[model samples]
Target: MLFLPAFLTLLGSVSAVDIWLNFQTTNCRGSGSVLCPGLEPNTCCSVPGRTGNPYTSVTVMHIPSVWNLDCRGHAGNYCGPIRELQTSNGRNTVCLGRGPFGGGGYGFWNGRVAATAESAAEGNCTRPSIVSLGDGTQYDVADLNDDDFNEMILLLTSSFHSFDIVEADGISDDVPEKFNINKLDEASLLPRYY
Candidate 1:
């Protein structure tokens, strides 16, 4: 299954709020360096350029995997790690690193590999893979190839202002482990929908 890590940081026009779930992130520890301190477990940093060593600055994130990735006989049925990424100019996209700074990917999709994928055993793979959510929404998934699940999922929305990526908390028989995508706040819709 594809797991959206239990944490997300939203820095928007409104405010900066860091939300955390009990899940662990994978970006730190053993990329040719001693494990950095104060990082969320499994999390590592991402940068647009190499102004400094990666283990020093930048924020790390959990990247989504290429679940159904298929390559020729050279590789198949593997979930590769994303190896590079950075925030887009407008914060609208999380793109793969490139140019004098250097990023992975042989060519370009949208002028850069939107995400990077590599199997420890196999080779490279392309991205922006299509997925249909259980809630009936379709998504275009991209990985930054930064060695984690720090990819982007593009969803068509009526408005950017109303769009939210929500992580629900607590467990109740009244509420399902599987979230209802239609209700970002779950109970916020009761009076109107029920």
Candidate 2:
């Protein structure tokens, strides 16, 4: 949600204090690199304050799989352990390393992967493929919107990389509509991942 502060003045010139309220934020880790650390990955992360502001505006976070306990058949699901990233400017170059030269040593999301499907020969399909939690497939966290909330975009990267958006409510109750990537809009009423 976007918080637009209202101004209360007598003559449109006298203002005492400007209050910034209800800015969406995530408290993810930082990697202190020249790259856009965890700006737009399959998860959410916290971006530290830059040279201009005293508070940060961005963060990183992850969504547990709705299909399984661990991430299976999902590559690039891990958010942390990110080595380097690249972006473009007018004509200059920026690079973030592992040193203290303005490079943050923050960490990103690092999660465990799900176990492989059991072999039929070994025994029965004791571990059921489909569980109560929406068929035990496994989903990764991603940001569908850039508005910046802790909302989770469930990702299923298998033969094809498909995604769904779900507002996790802690326990397995009231699982909302699955997040669809094609339906994402910059100004849509849906929450932003920025």
lDDT of 1 by residue, 87-121 (tens): 22223112221211111221111222323223222
lDDT of 2 by residue, 1-194 (tens): 12211221121123111101001121211211011221212221222221211111111112212211111111111222223332212211122222111111121122311111111111211110111122222222233333221222111111111222111211223334553322223321111212
Best by lDDT: 1
Model 2: what TM-score? 0.16
Runs in model 2 deviating more than 4 A are 1-77, 90-156, 161-194
Indicate which candidate wins on TM-score: 1
Question: TM-score of every model?
Answer: 0.17, 0.16
- lDDT agreement with native, every candidate: 0.21, 0.19
